[model samples]
Target: MPRRLIIDLMRASCDVPFVSLARTLNIRPLLEARGAAASPPGFAAVFVKAFALVARDEPTLRTLYVKWPWPAFYELPRNIAMVATARVEDGEPCVLPQRVGDPDRLTLAEVDAIIRWGKEAPADQVPAFRKMLLTTRLPWPLRRLAWWVGLSFGRQRANWFGNFAVTGVSAYGGGELHALSPGPYILSFDVAKPDGTIGAMIRWDHRVTDAALIARTFARLEEVLNGEIAAEIRASRASEPKPVRAIGA
Candidate 1:
């Protein structure tokens, strides 16, 4: 069964706009195909790579919006960082691999390696992962207190921890096309369809990014995915053929 903790956390604080964005992307068919595949590693790698490439091309895609009483601000970053939670065994607690970035630069082999490593990391790391997972474990009042503390020190320390958060549902048979939540920084994508068509849903912090900027970023990403990146992948595959051994006389 899914963790009750996670479920409750989501119920209490779920972003309805984010969910709506997912629904708009129309990723069901793609997710269905992915789920049916015997091996999904390649697909997952491709999706991650695509996201990375898109982020690279459109730096704003990696940014977050921060709202202040007077005005809102934007934060620009170089990479799209995300977290992945993996369960090592049935009924075992999930371990989170934090801040996997630049998925586009990683080859399928590399992605597979990382997944393997993430799942098998030392037991000691598990506790840290759990802590991150249970960040919502704090009572609402305590959470507010921490946020206040974080904000109080952030200006002087140049650290703003709650800039943004992104969660991936593709691994769970959720359809292609990522979704973003409106915040300092939040984005998600649905699984890709078998036909190579993808829908991208973006939620931006209105305070930081206007609709025009978000649209521009999305358009650039579409071009990258459908044009150069897609072409490159196809070319790479086409250049390689299965090797056969010659029969000895």
Candidate 2:
């Protein structure tokens, strides 16, 4: 069925104890610099790298809780982003995650290229889609069993599903109050207001952390966006070739 994969994904997401924390961020500086870039990167790419940078310094954001093999926390060595991307399957629109590992270590252009690949490439060509499709085509009982085994094992879970997700409906002109994912952390953001503030929410597995840490993470996200992310945009603009002057003005 076209919807079977999404159904299984939701089923697994339901098992996690997710909690959300929302904040209004002022990122006018980054937004302005991005608007001025010769070729601006997508907001999804911007948010992905910004969050990964923050997670790089905060171990809690990169930690996950493992159920089977005894309940315990699993902390990844680097940030793996599972970014939700839209695709059409058999005349039906479906969303699949594009995994970008160690995004914090990559440039904004590199991250954008990977996200664009997930969007434009055929489903079979994308590793996440290939894996999900193959599993979805399996018999119902076996499909469910695969999800259980993958989710129960900490290392396998991280490799297959990733540790954090970045998703939003803002491009559709609205914010997502809550987005579901199988990762330990999920970040959703809305369009900016006239005052240049945007509503951002971070829904995380409470089993791994609490509100206080998320609150602090938000502050760091703002800083990274304005500091590192914004700098990248400006740098890109500066690196663009200057226009040739006319013989006579």
What do the candidate models score in CA lDDT, each in turn?
0.47, 0.89
- The TM-score that candidate 2 achieves is 0.96
Please state every model's RMSD to the true fold in angstroms: 6.3, 1.4
lDDT of 2: 0.89
Over 89-150, each residue of candidate 2 has an lDDT whose tens digit, in order, gives 77788788899989999999999999999988988999877888898899988988998888
Best of the candidates, TM-score = 2
lDDT per residue (tens digit) for residues 25-113 in model 1 = 33344444345444444444554555567666665555543323333344444444443446654656753533444456766456555
Can you give the lDDT of residue 54 in candidate 2? Answer: 91
Question: After superposing candidate 1, which stretches have Cα over 4 Å from the reference?
Answer: 1-44, 67-74, 84-97, 102-112, 119-185, 191-195, 231-244
TM-scores of the models, in the order given: 0.58, 0.96
